[model samples]
Target: MYIIFIGTGWFSYVFSLVNLDIYFSKNHWDRYTNFAELSLHILCAIGIYIGRFLRFNSWSLVTQPKHFLSILPGELIGKFPLVVIVLTIAIIAGLYALCKPLVAKSSLYRE
Candidate 1:
């Protein structure tokens, strides 16, 4: 959790230092940065989903908020199919993995 916060903080700090909008507009280095940023955001989303399901509470909120905003601009690139599919898969997998620990001791049938 602490590690996730540190990583997210570092990623945001580095992202703030660059002119990503302008870079994309000029077609200079945007492809690499966009892919990297997308990958990172997807991972963060998965992390947040897992944390929430497991009630981890640490660094989940910090990382989760960015997921909504990041996906908006992502649509502009017309790189939809792959990124969306990957993110969906990641989220589903995270939820499934987290659910086991969370639901393992819970009763499925009401007695």
Candidate 2:
């Protein structure tokens, strides 16, 4: 249950990063893309933490929005959320560093 949610979050976060890169590069703002990508990663990390700890998934924004909204304010400002976001970002960044070398060396990015 929890594992599934975390897995989904991880996939969504990584894909969002790739999409963000494509978008920024296409727009010719490559210089600013890294900052934007990191920002989004931090936000997604917080979102994932909220879902994991508060039991509020993304659809809650459409279905049970009030429940989701009610908790968001406090959660976003809390020390716990900060810790979770920082830790999540660290993990994601480390994974990216590990994978980036392999990805760059591969022919996949040659296009």
| TM-score against native, each model | 0.29, 0.72
Q: Residue 53's C-alpha lDDT in candidate 2?
A: 88
- How many residue pairs clash in each candidate at the backbone level? 0, 0
lDDT of 1 by residue, 2-101 (tens): 9999766744433432334346647776657656545555666655544443344555457765764465345434545455556665654455445433
Model 2 TM-score, 2 decimals? 0.72
Candidate 2 per-residue lDDT, tens place, 1-111, comes to 999997666655555566667777898989997798677667767777888988887788999888778878987897887888899988878776665455545554442
Which portions of model 2 miss their true places by more than 4 Å?
Answer: 1-23, 108-110
Candidate 2 achieves a global lDDT of: 0.74
lDDT for 10 (candidate 1): 47
Please report how far candidate 2 places residue 87 from its true position, in Å. Answer: 0.9
Residue 63 Cα positional deviation in candidate 1, in Å, after optimal superposition: 17
